[model samples]
Target chain A: MTDAPDRPADAETGTDLPAGPADSDAETDPRTDGGLPAMDGAVPTRDPGAFSQLATALGRPLVVGTVLVTVVFLILPVLATFAASFAHEWAGVLPTFVRDGEFLTLVNWRQALGLTQTDLGAQRGLGGFWTVFGVPIPVTIGFSMLLALGGVVINLLVGVPIAYAVTRYDFYGRGWLNTFAVLPVVPGIILGVAFLKTYSDLPSAVGLMIGYSLLKAPYMVLAVQSSFESMDLRQLEESARSLGASWPRTFLTVVVPNAKTGIVAGAIVCWTLAAAEFNFSYIVYSSGPKPFSLFLFENISNNPFLQAAAAISVYFAIVVVVTALLQAVGQRGFALGGVR
Target chain B: MSTLDEGPLVARLRTGTEALLSPTTETDRERRRIAALALPFVALAVFGAVVPLVVMFRISVAEEYLTATAGVQFDAWVTLLASILAFVPGVGSAVDADPVYGEVIWNSLWFGAVTTVASVALGIVIAHALEKYDLPGEGLLVTLISFPISLPGIVAAFMMIVWFGKTGLLTNVFVWLGGEASLFPAVTSNEVKLTGRPSGTTIAVFGLFLGYLYSMVPRATFLLRGAYAEVNTDAEAAARALGATPWQTFRYVTLPQIRPGIVGAVILTFRTALAIFGTVLVLKALSVVTFRFDQILKVGYDLPTASALAGLFFFFTVGFTFLSLRFTSAEVTG
Candidate 1:
């Protein structure tokens, strides 16, 4: 414990070894004379303990192996699924990317996106494109994106203010309110079951948007709360107030703008998640355009393996783009709220 | 004194409303501001969650099915409770009810528990390595690991099939290595009955377990990473300087600090595990409670029973999560 002060000096001398030979000589003299005695006294001179020896021999390998294996286990299939989406067949150990001597083909992609009709039926693909002004957008993906965007809009409206209230104020039931705001109240399946009889007359898209907002609100709240927690909200509010700005103006112009990064990142995460939400969408979806998750489910449950891969790869493409955007906004992917 | 006729509670409530509606004092103004900020969330919660859940409970006990819920019936609750009671070995014989509900609930609890422990354990290791060691491309590693967190449970099940299905990569590798195709675990082959072994159920359940882990491990890892970030490295270094081995340093110093985090991770991850429906829906390996809800709703259209089961599940999760958090020192950031 006492030698803690010498640790940084030792590291400094080690790094400074080749930079300046003359200066390093002076540094090394004290490090060797002083740090060496302390290290010698602290370190055991006898045979290494059994546990120490075992840890020294196998610790790094064990930990590194677990990380390596877990990474491979988690990522290999994502890559494989994405690759298989473009492949012609996957009869053997590996998916064969070549078809008719061509290295790769977009037949699966085209079929999966509902661009080509197949014997698999019209329900199999994304159900054709919804063209806007001469630009065609895949209907299912576009609709789901819009629905999830609706959810994001609701989340921002509902999450940001509550996050500010909980982080900035001290009031009765504040802790409980904060917990409720940041922790999901119910799972999607339950919510779907609840929605069945309660809002049976509501439009499927509207119900889904509301459900998505409620289901994914916790993420938005958590993200925004983290941003709020980092800032001294009271100070900021007071400063803005002292500058003759109204409370609403301070919150809208100062506080909300300051946490723009978190809001954007939260929106990206919530949008992607809501778009891919399956349990609620599956239960509540009776008629109308299929959400992206239901589309993936149809492909997975009924379509061919390659086409299913292609369908799932469509989502992978969305998540990859969202992840890149999140990184740009200073969050490490979905680390902020990975639940659900 | 003038409002004594209304009773103290009503008078207080009136005053509270008045203060909220029109506040002159600074304290009252702050209180009103807080209420204004909280109003939207409260409104959303009431309409979106509270109202629906209340209607669900009404449907759970409603006398009829899809039409207007006229009258009250305890039939669904009675049957559900009887089924749960029938799961007990001796009580089951006496109750004379199908143990399917009990079985599914048991499967969910055990599966959720097993997966929670496994994933949280694995998470600790992954988080330790990421925080302690200088692993190359750490940011990329985090991104890749967290990438799955965005993938829905159905996609996770698909990933499992890509690995363990009959035409899956690992299964084919084993087949190539001269193993009997019948003995291998594949999502496609459920009919291969091997001698002296129950291969089919085990294979499917194991695949589902892997699917659960695929979704769970990253969540647990990220949860613990938050805890790992706050560990005092100075104490760890001091312990190491005192001749403690790497394992000792971790076991004595690091583990104690992150134990609360581990607890929190276990709680949240277990909640995640229990709520898992899409993966089970896709795999169709084991009939857990969530999957049972699908069967009740889709196959038989048993709305009341489904509502009853869902209500029970929601209460259990909310109660368990809140009670555990209140009692323990678990800090949940996510």
Candidate 2:
């Protein structure tokens, strides 16, 4: 608000209105003849204009309140869901941590992860598990992770080169190509429908991988493009070339190594998204191991509330880890891409 | 002399291919390099997107899509067009067809637009606060906000259920406050009517609206934040120094600078809204076009109608997005 700016300024200047008449006079005396005499009538006074006063009183709170409310709205459900996943009962105003005088339980988490057997018919936990070196991994989560990683691999191959080309070279139709690379040309569901008809005989994993790479290539392009834009790519390429490095060598070693952070961040984001991509997976998934997102969909629509919470919390945990990794790689939590 | 033996087009093509295969000049080498770099993306786009989309269009008019796309027919297109026409108020009585597709498409547009506007308006406020004000834990605030962007739409819907379901936090609070339980916006069941007053009717659609906002606000905020990061702070400071109130400074100076960004965010966010399927599917509050695709494909096995609807949706979105960006001064930064 109008007063919001003044209060900070007043604090920084060590001046206060209504403190004393003499001090107020001392504050205004220098301004009258200092810069603009014609604006003497508009100088600060004990009473500001009605509009300014109204704005000062309301604007800061309005903006700050919106921010606070938005943050709470966005974050509270996540926290609550996580907490409820570990709680005993959620049939009241708050999820209770005590059941039958025992405080807290991991039953929901255990059941959600397929770590324990449950009596609930039709609402099965992660249905199958694959044993790898004596360690059992949930088949749904494992398959989805591999599937999403495949997408990321393709994204790297396809996205990194286009990003480099757009940034480091000039060509006809460069703008259009850049737009296409960075903007998603097709939504996932549409692509899923297309895949269903075009590649009816293709394996689900391969189809999903290709679909994911096409759907999420934009994120990779945008992220790498940001990093490429930050560096003097032309200079780097030329320097490498002058040092007797071939163009391909320069691109693979010099250019790519320089954009490591962006590439890593892009891969992490794309993997996380593809793992939990429900719309396309929901439509195109015909057989074989269910994607993690479909498992989540099953849990959400069919299972009990607490069970659903636990299922979603599994993803929330993956995202949290991925976010941390993204931060470590020097991007601010998926900010590099305009759309997911 | 060799060029005289061939036509210009053929000669140009031969030279172009020769340049790409074995370039003898710097320009040709550079051209080859560009081609090499662009080849992978082009290949993927062609095989993954273009080819499949063409096949989908073919299927839309196929006589029998499931067994084999043996013959072409316009029956699916006719049904789709007639259904859409049936939903129009003036033309409804003449069409003599179900208006479900038309209703769903209308729902998608109106809902998408409403959510886009709300999200962008809030985005401006949030982005302005983050950029202009010195808030504590700005990094953490950003991380929390952008977290939802990583979540799929189904999770977003579940988050809504966590907040507004029958035993949800807010619904419980309202019930505890001497209010009738039925009056609250509780997403109890799919049978909950999407329309009418909340006193006797369930407000599941309101819960869905909030679900849409949950996903959209963060995306819109982040999109606008990119614009905010480039705002000329000096002008704002100068306006403030010249006795301009905060609101006045923003209204007069900041708004014009970020107008393009606002437009860009609106376009992108509206696209996000239209493409949102998982949330509507899980919530089952209103029958949007995306949900209709699920019903057509999964329940009725009506591939042609679904393909026709999807084609129309795809063209509208792609056309709207590209044309707006081309015609407007919208600055869409990644």
Candidate 3:
């Protein structure tokens, strides 16, 4: 929706209806039926042709203008963060270009990437290592992927059975269990506090895993369960049972294969959500074995703005790329459930 | 009616006779097998969700302080009740009148309500616009519009900072403009300066409104689009043919059809806004219950008090969810 200076004339096609008065007289087209008579009714009061044209001219740009502004608002942060990664003391509505007739500094990029140590405070290590299991890992992306994947695994293990049970049975507590599945909607920090207070004895990583899985389970359940609901379980299961397959065997072999797309969709969504999870991670994670979000949040204030922006952009890029992939996948099979 | 009454009873009697005849029947084994299949999920939920909530309630009621020494005593529940009642007209005052409770609760409600209304209103319009228009690159536009839903709250908070924080691009623009404005004193007032400071309550609330909108709009759009698709466009064409203005047609014909979507969006946005944590945290606005709860629990380490807040918050969630369920059920039945 950004206002491109080179906006094509055809861009206005979305808003400007063919039913405008000027085009109405040429009523050979099926879509312009109402336009001619409506213009005829209003012609005595004013020149309807000019008025409609003016309205069309005014309305289209106005809609486009609002859209452009919204787009800017939507993407300003990412753009600003990306710009700041290479900016040398950016302080304006937009980053300055051609500073002294040359490109601005890449000092922020280097500082952010841990290639060089800037004299940031001692507490703020200059893009230093994030430790996992007492071993320092230089790449935050790998660690992030691992934590997210761990959440995915945990959710699949927990969610698949829940989905199966709820979809496949008319159980006693089915209604209540279905209600309880939506426990993910409870804010992560609440669960964070709950888990921290309750499982004070357990390791932080375990707490994180449990918390994330609990939060992520609903989505996985919903995804797989919807797929199951759409399927004719009686036909599939009965057919399998008739073929001398045991219930569990039929379920594992037949049902699981049918809902494979849903499982994968759920896993991808769960992974992305876990990767983006910050509040719970912030509360649950101590110094060791940090998630990427915590990794960024910790360095936000202490590190240089550009350096911090670089780190944020890294995560932002990951989120956008993963989300785009998810969207592409969503277009094929399962709907991505909302998570905040 | 006779069959309905006697069928289950007859079956039970026959099953009893069968069970007596054969102690380990196939039906019994099959029932056990099905129950066993459902057990794992039930166990997981009980351990993960039910146990934690129970423990949370227990901790909330347990006394953080005794008369002389800290002990796992009772009376916090009484205090909690009193605090709740104190908000009532006739109830005079709370015994443990911590100002934080009043401020946090009030702020949570006020901010949550504002954000919900704003987000829902915007969502309706956006949803309508996206659907009603034959927009070019509509899919891409839809994707762009909905992309914020996938953004983590922390990232949204950071985006807020990037746009509006001190040293932010927008703030810098204001500062630079202010410098230029001084040269034209007749036009520019002293109040025109951008201080480049952290936002106050009003601005923070606005920022949160934006954040909530960012999160909720896509979801609302998704839901409403389905609702919109189901809407009878013939009715809209009829209204248009009858010379009703587009706005009038939308108000009269279209809105009623999408009321369920609107209600769903309202409930969802309200719930999310009330429970939102990261935005409030990054904005340094601890006025709301969720942030206050985190602060009290994690930072202050006042387990009893924090637990009370959490307990209250949990109740709020449950109550709203009940209301939401009621609405959905009503919509279904009626």
Candidate 4:
């Protein structure tokens, strides 16, 4: 709730470490910026006239405004959906709102979460209501979650061996493997669709795994590789090898701990993507239990008030919650590299 | 065939093979095995990206267009492959069927243009502001602002619809202002016409833009801000002291240095826009026949048109990607 002295701005409680002068020197050096000191440390001073001091104090608004705008862009629509769900009825023109004061109710939840959809005639002008995924929440969300989680687990398992191989020793295809792993995002779905089309006859879930793995595996490989890159592997291997420790014992006792942060980050990324997934899930399974995005898409109705269908707002809410939870976990673990 | 060449060469080759098979240490053995295993992953990447994209490009050229009959037709595919020079008119006819296709393109481009400029502008401003305005929550603000990275583009669209729709709270605020139909258009019913037009394409495009802005701005901010952060103040002060306006300083000094990031941002924005059918379609129920919206969704929803559109987009994407890479490399290393 803190506001800069003379400005109106939203409340903020940020956590990145402050920009320091030493970081500035590397840039502001003559070689980089023509010998000028980095102006990152420069502060804007107010005029010598009245309110000079007051103007200087309003720094929070200037800086926090950008964050607020971003939040307002992101969170407000979702909060509104939560509001729409509660209000018993919606009727409006422009700023029009629900006539009934009820702004919170489990009816939206009850209807949406239940496995069966009710055809409430005009009120629920939708197709048949038998749940597609065995639940109102849609089996797709569950499946996608499982898929992404599966992806995280699988990639971490696969990527670690891959990383260790590259870091500890040399191989013929090592450079090519590394390059393949870090290649930037191309149209991954084109590849996803190709694999899906070729393997459509198979159990779709397996097809999905293969399709998503095409993208996720590489991400994991790169993340793990970078972590390995910075690692002081000699310390771990030497420590174990010097102590008459077997290769397995040395890897277990030393190497694993050093790579924990990167692995955890990659896992978080994999899981979040799996849960939040769309395209690969879409192209792979068509309309079945695969993509969490289907649940999110249910609410984008011509009837805007029926936001349960276009639950993307809900998607954002879940994202915020997940992030908060991860932060809590990272803080608790004193995480060296928390998921970004 | 002769039993084989009998010479010292055979003996030398056998020794080499033996050396390769026999490792001196456990780690070396493990490393050899891993290298062997890694071949699959490389094969998978090649199979996944390189092969499919090549196939898609080839398929795009096949004139035997996939219709409702096949979703991938043969004649169109052949036509595409044969003429080599004929892809332009072929795709052009496909896209021009929609009246809004051009408008949608303009709108999408405009959307990309506006959002790109806005995000880039905001990114640079925030980067500079973070330095000048070292407020209490500054660090947190930067981190929070940069966090929309993981929020999917589609999710952002829904949030925006709820936030900006006629029944949305903001729209509700406008309603409170005496049912201002001009400022706030009707969102609830298809019965209600918007700004004299009911098509949700432009509205949908706006929604997509906002979503993309959220996702891309943070990326832009992160990359450009990092670039700016590395810049020395003395250089900025020098520019400022040399009679440069604040705008001029940013343009002359800051802009060129961060050009690579800006180019990356453009490629990123263009890439997403090219593939943005999902968000646009979901938001507007975008149609090809009516063709009034930024056709962003319509771009890919229709099979033949989308196939053609996708091919066109792939060309642009590859070209832009290559161009950006070339330019960025030239700038950085030059």
Candidate 5:
């Protein structure tokens, strides 16, 4: 426990070394053991020994096969959806005309986006583009983005202070504060229903924004606190104080910038999740402007195959892009990323 | 005698108070003040999240609303006790001939267990492989595997249908290969037919399973990968140097160190599967408690019953959450 202070630094430098080589140096001197090759480094040199050569030949295929199988399993659904999003017709598990030139078509895209003619003559709103809600598919997309953005802003405002205080200060009930932040995230579906029932009187949009921020802020707090805890906060603060900057100014200018990676990563995760949230949005926002998720849910059941695919593809694109950005920024401690 | 005794005691207390109240440093005072900044967030979380859940619990016990189909039951406790006892093999099934709540609970437990075991096992294997071996395209593989974590449950469920529904790509492939046309499970219950459960097919359950696995496996992998990365390879190497087999080294040296991560992944997957709603609804599976709770409110128009069901669900969820916090010392979100 006393060595905890030095561990993180050690970890930072120690990540690249394989366990085998490090162990060989300590207890069992690998060179003295039956002339067997030592697993000294990560990459094996082209050793002339038969055993070394055989080990490489045997291990290579196993690694490749495992990676290949895992990748395929993870990617199969996305590939299937991406393919179905464009195909005009389905023949069993595949498109009807993939073997020929007509395998690809834009009809589904057109119909889904409300660019095509509406099948209902009297209810003709350009292929479900215009609905009773007086909004188009594009509008819903915009609404979803706005809602997500609003949630991100609200969460950051609530999360940053808590993160700062808990990480940098010693205070009463600080432990409880951390737990409080996390409580909202535990029972997602139940909370959604609970919010609906509890705040039935509050206007739909206002209630949803509150619910979303409550749900999303914890992820931010957790991430930002981690970034703050890992930082050399006292040293930085002392330097800023010696330079005559006020504590608030130092926190705003120095502390926040240092934690920017975690903040950005947490925001991306929060925004994407808020945009894609369906249960709360479905239950709570039923009366007001429906988000893209609800719109997709409504259309998926009865809409033309092409239209459903197109709408889903658009939403999918948004979430994937934002999520990809999150991965890029902080794959270590961002999206359900490690706590410590 | 009384005055002298009181005066000395008061003087001693005053000195102690003075010593305690004196400021240590300017920065310490600043930090103490700054710590109050967390108060508002605490208040907001309490009011927004905690209060609502508490109200749900209150509604469960309170005889609040009376519906035409099902009247208000102060007997929520009775129902809860009955439901719990229903977990026994044959005794509970005889209590409720409809077998609705019992079957739903049974299905939820089974699905949660299956999903937890499968995802955790896959996570351990893949995370170990990624951490230990230098695989080609490692970056892309990690990204792809973890991609579904960000996807909405509804979208994942929609993707499942797109891939495996009646006219789905996989279904068509099965046909092309001269096999059965659908990969979906057959439904046995008629009450949820409108929810799109095919007769004799558990497709709804299967769809929900896919949605859970699609996201949970990646999440598990992400978590376990970190655990694997943090593992002290020195110990494993030491064990290996002593001529222990690879499996022995893993079981003795590696597994114990990563036990918390393994527990974290299992609990997260299980709890997420338990709380899953949008995916189950989109896929039309009503066996899970979340969907059933929602349905009781919306379709049955029985708020009290719904509240009771939610309360019971929360009971199970809270138990799992306690386990999760104990294991990982953090709250996990789906």
Candidate 6:
């Protein structure tokens, strides 16, 4: 910033410079633009199609060695688990896992689908009980579905009012409101637990719904703000007041449609997280109704049953599949789109 | 008819609430309001999550918290040796008693660190590859990679149990393909077999990594994809126009740009792995209590000691998370 080029310019385009330092202190100075040097633009090149050279550097001893060691040391067990889901009767050899297959049986998938457990301490789950009437799939998966649905439903209600306040009017604590909403969503079991303790002894199911909304509402509000931010306020109110429409009607017709995608995508993220949840479910529902993940936990603890495992797998598979389908249909571009 | 259009009442009511919004108020009033709103939520979170931990910590340090077997005593720390001696008779009883706590914590931390480091690195590579496979089953592959996220940890654990366990498909397939002698679980004699134990912290960590990675990779890929878009393509072209190696251009340009994304994803994954309970409990069945809470409680609950430990655990978790999130968010947002 000491350089003439980086120093403040006329209030024209905000950043109208060609983006370089003044030519004076080139040799001794490190930073050319802000803290980053402008010489970063220049790189001496070698061959055409030299993209392979980057790949070659990736193969350097440090990179290759670290990657291999990580895979062997860290990822191998995960790989083992993924394969074990298809297993049955192999537990003796694979003592670490609940089920080990002596011979491949579709039984894990079957029992997971709500068939009777040959072993102890397992139950039917949401994936298995799927139908039009909606039979309750027992255990972790079912509980998760309920939590996810509850999160979405509650957020839709919570988000609309907050969105309206930010969008239609200049509201109180608008800046800090934005921060307070988002500040909770990051993973921390301690803070969340602390929040719930004040409202304890009620149903944990209620806690799950409320907690998820509290965490997700900020993200939803942030997303909704984008649509609210980009709006032209004059046309919206002028037309409404002129045509004898109320403030609510004008918002419903003009505002909501434009912001619909952001809200939907935000809601999806909120609910998906609820469905794919863990820590709270484990801690909150210590004696309450177990969710799909918790039920899955019971399966592993009681000794693995292929049917039970498969049932749980199918439930989640269905969720992911549905999400992907929705994502595909919703928007084609914008990688950071509200789909979250 | 026009009289029904009275907006005064509604406007007044709305204004009533909005009046509390202040440009200038006593500092204490604002602080009090903030605390009031925050305190309730904070209290709720504690009762639900921290109470059990509080109970654990109190007993660890106190006279007694649990109303179960044994007297109102606070000598559980000393008796930790006695339990170890009973469980596994001691070559060196008092010194390394309750080694499960040490072993499990080590296993958890090492596994978490390695997996996070690995995933961030591989996710970048795989994401780059997937951008244009121009091949078949791309959708399925992407979905499969993300399977662990939506899928629960227990389910993943069970899956690993079946697939990598001694009689699992891979092992069975290996044996079926006539590699039994070289394959795992070879039964030379009735008494001599090669099946491995399915319950251990190692596999549990493995299960955790899968679940964490499946959730993390998509986000990381998204971040990197954005990072990749931000790359000055013209600079690369200029570099190619000169005599720079691709490695040189990437080292000098691409990697520096993507550093923030990589760090953020790594932090997210590490936190997720550390706090995981489902996989560890299910896989090991809580037989191996890793940290101080589980270990001390397994020893009789000395109220004051347990409370101190719980406070430490709570503080440690909060401090670690807050610091990491601060660093990662700053790195990215800045």
Cα TM-score of candidate 2: 0.89
* Residue-by-residue lDDT tens digits, candidate 4, A202-310: 7777666655666666456655665777877877688788989877677767787788766775666556656665555545565445366545555453334454632
- DockQ metric, candidate 4: 0.21
Give the Å error, residue A98, model 2: 1.8
Selected candidate, larger DockQ, 1 vs 4: 1
Show where candidate 2 strays beyond 4 Å.
Answer: A4-52, A118-127, B1-7, B179-202
In model 3, where do residues sit more than 4 Å from their true spots?
A: A1-68, A96-106, A113-141, A168-173, A183-185, A332-340, B1-37, B63-72, B78-96, B173-200, B232-245, B327-334
Give Cα-based local distance difference scores for all models: 0.85, 0.85, 0.65, 0.52, 0.67, 0.50
Classified by CAPRI criteria, candidate 6 counts as: incorrect
Q: For each candidate, what's the DockQ? A: 0.43, 0.47, 0.23, 0.21, 0.30, 0.14
- Overall local distance difference test of candidate 1: 0.85
After superposing candidate 1, which stretches have Cα over 4 Å from the reference? A1-49, A117-120, A123-125, A337-340, B1-4, B179-200
**Against the true structure, what is model 2's DockQ?**
0.47
Shift in Å, residue B144, candidate 2: 0.2
Interface RMSD of each: 3.8, 2.8, 6.9, 7.3, 7.9, 9.1
Q: Which digits, one per residue and each the tens of the lDDT, describe model 5 over residues A1-340?
A: 1011122225333343334656556534645656766544333221113333343445446545765776675577676666677876765545654545665777677666655556352123222333437655545666677788888888888888888887777666776666666544546667766775688778777777777888778678877876887898889988998999987788889988999987988888788778877777776665655676777786676676656777778766776677667767855322355321
Order of models, best DockQ first? 2, 1, 5, 3, 4, 6
True contacts kept of each: 0.75, 0.72, 0.29, 0.20, 0.48, 0.17
TM-score of chain B of each: 0.93, 0.91, 0.77, 0.62, 0.76, 0.59
Q: In model 1, what lDDT does residue A210 have?
A: 94
Query: What DockQ does predicted model 3 obtain?
Result: 0.23
Choose 2 or 6, whichever is better by TM-score.
2
| Model 1 Cα lDDT, one tens digit per residue, B190-309 | 232111123237766777888899999999999999899989999999877776667767877899899998999999999999999999888888889999999898888999999999
- Candidate 6 root-mean-square deviation in Å: 11.8
